[model samples]
Structure formats: C-alpha cells, structure tokens
Target: MGAPVEIRGLSYAYGSGDLARPVLREVGLAVGPGEIVLLTGPSGSGKTTLLTLIGALRAMQAGSCRVLGQELAGAKEAQRVLLRRRIGFIFQQHNLLGFLTARQNVAMALELDPGTDEAGRLARAGRMLEAVGLGDRTESKPAQLSGGQRQRVAVARALAGDPGLILADEPTAALDRQSGGEVVRLLRELAKQRGVPILLVTHDPRILDIADRIVAMEDGRILPTEKAEPAPAA
Candidate 1:
C-alpha cells in the first residue's frame, strides 16, 4: 500500500465572532507516498492553515483529514498528540530551542516515543543531523548556527523520528537563494529516501521544480493539480 493522504471537504475558520471569516473551505486533495507536494498561494490564502490541518496542529472544524490511515477530524486531544509524533514538521521560523544543541533538539523527538534507549536515541539523532550536513555541529546550539545551518538542523530534528509524513511551512524562507535551493533539495531527497510524503507550504516559486505535484490555494479553497502516478519506490 502507498503512503496516501486523503482529505475530503476540509473546512476551517478562525474565531467564533463570525462564521463568514472562514479560513479554509471545502479543501480536498490526496498525495501518495514519496510525493513532494507544493502548496502555494498569496498571503492570507490559507496555505499555512492547510498545512497545519494536515499536520494535525489544528482542529478540523469540518470534513475529514486522514494521514497514514489515522483520521484526525474527530480525534481527541490526546489522540492528536499521538498522531503528531508520527509526523515531521518544519516551520518557517526554524523553531529550535536556543538552549538545546542540534543533537539535543533532534533527540527530543525520539524521547517522545516510548521504550527508546538512550544510546539508540542519540545514534538516531546523530544520523539525522549527519544526513542534513550537520554532523560536526551536533553540539552547537541554535544561536551558534547560521540561518541555513539552523534550518538544516530543523530538518534534521523533523526527520529524527522516521516520520511517515513531513509537513514543511516555508522551510526555505529564511535562507539565501542558493541555501534555500539546498534546503528544498534536502527535503525532497529525504522524503524520497525515507518514502515519506512531503507537504510543503510556500509562496516562493523557486522550489516548485522539486515538487512532483503542486496544489494551489486561494480564498480558503484548494484547486486540484495534475495527478501523477505514485513513484515506484515510495
């Protein structure tokens, strides 16, 4: 079976003051395993909102969202927390703790999973950082790393748990053009190598070439992109 994502008539809105100000409406899409999907739109187009919903960071007010066979729409808070642990997330800000070293940040995710021994956890964290080109900087804190390096550390942190899916929100926004391209490439390569589906939310057009599919959102609605056959390896 493929690592399929099925979203059906998804809808969401912020604030209870007025229902007219919905952020997402009737959004629907699917991505198979190893697919790199780009979610692009203008500002306030609900790109981030959609990514959050898919990642189980926000409650689904309507419709259904299923990732790796887990339904999120009606899941309880505890269940949502459990679901999130299985998925990797990279935010635009590289939200790393300033006090923690790169290796520590990655290892933190492994700690969330039960029965992970200390040696195995650290080894996995080290491998993830190494994969993102941060092998020697494992001990470096976030403040010590450059913008690109920090973002790479964030990528390493996200991949530490061997998540089945990765949701990245403008992960390359903080880097220079060259560095941004490298980060995007790294994300695509990791998704392919791990057979994990990647949903990247961004307005930048530079990295669209790396995406196997592109879904455009505007005014809280998702427009379908051309469907391609699932990559054989994923």
Candidate 2:
C-alpha cells in the first residue's frame, strides 16, 4: 500500500469570515512510501499548520487532503481519530509525561490500540526504547533522563505502532549537533525499514541530507524550486 498522505490545492485559515487569517494557500504535496520529505521554511511560514492538517490535528479548511486514501476535506471527528492512529507524530517538545517512566510513556502509545495486553505493551515499549538506545534508561522518568534520552523515548513512543506515516516537527531542534544528527539518522533508518513515509518540518540544514526531497514554504504557499517546477510531490 502507498504511504499515507496526498494534498492538493489545500488552503486553511485560523478564523472565519473577515476576521480569518490564512495559514495555508493552495498548498499541494505528496509523500510516497519510504520517502523522507523535508519541509523547510521560516517561522510563520505555515509549515506547522500543514503538518497539523496532515496529522488530522486540524480539520481541512478547503481542497483535497486525502490521508491513507481517505478524503479529509470534511471528515468527521471520528474519522480523524481513526486516521490519526495510523500515523506517528514526533514533536519538538518531546511531550513525554513528566510523571511516567520512559517505558511507561512509550507503553501509553500501545493503549491506543485495543488488542494489546499490558505484558505485550511493556514488552514492545521496552524493545522500542532499546532500539532508540535507551534500554538502560527505560525506568527513568522524564526529569531524570537527559534531554536527548527523553527525546529518544518520545521517538520510541511515536514508532511503537509502526504507523505507515510519520509527521515530525523540528524533532531535533532542541538538541546539540551530535544528538540531533543521531535522532535524524534513527528516523531515516526506521522510516525506510518499514517503508513508512515521513514528513519532517525543520529549519536545521544539518539534517537536510537525510531527506529524499526538500520543499520550502514561504508565507502560506510552497515555493517552487529553481527548476520552476513544484518541489512537492503531486
């Protein structure tokens, strides 16, 4: 199956009527399986807005945005929730539960799926943490682990489901150069390993080499490359 995500002429605004402020304008993009599409732009360039729309965290305002082949032009709340479960999201903040251990935080992802038991969840979470090189810190709480370790735990949690699509927002923004590169390498390896597509919104030039394609945005539209062709996939 193709990796989830297809957008065409997508536009969005924060408010309604005259008070509305446009966030995206005629944005079109596609992410194929096993591809890493890097989205780069200045702040307020609508990169995050587009990522949220693809993650179904925000409803589509206009145009075609089919995720996992399901049209999201006017999808219902229930539909959005279902679509979200099939995608992995890595945020710049890490967003780990402050009170939970690294293992518990990762296990929380398995809770979203109905059939996984407690034992299986823990086992899987442990393995994912291990994969992220945090096997020894699984029992540490967010406060106890270093920033890199915490972010690695977040990565572990995001991948627990092996979602067909991954949406990452400046995942390495807070880390040092080495830590950031390590995380980017891990993401690139995992995405290709399972043939999952990743849409990473980042300003870090250091990680650009990890992407198969790079698309830049300004204001609210995707900027065309020097070739005068759309940088985004159709």
Per-residue lDDT of 1-234 in model 2, one digit per residue for the tens?
Answer: 534788999999998999999989999898888888899999999999999999999888899998888889999999999989988999999999899999999999989778989999999999999998898988999999888888899899999997878999999999999899889888888877788889999999888878888899999999984222222321
What lDDT tens digits, residue by residue, belong to model 1 across residues 1-234?
535689889888888775557989998888898889988888899988888888888878899889888888888888888889888999889888999898888898899778888778888899999999999999999999999999998899888888888999999887899889889888878888788889999878788788888888889988767554443331
What value of lDDT does candidate 2 attain over all alpha carbons? 0.89
Candidate 1 stretches with Cα past 4 Å from truth are 1-3, 17-20, 224-234
What is the number of backbone collisions in each predicted candidate, taken in the order shown?
0, 0
Most accurate candidate by TM-score: 2
Runs in model 2 with CA error above 4 Å? 1-3, 225-234
What TM-score fits each model?
Answer: 0.92, 0.93
Q: How far is candidate 1 from the true structure (C-alpha RMSD, Å)?
A: 2.8
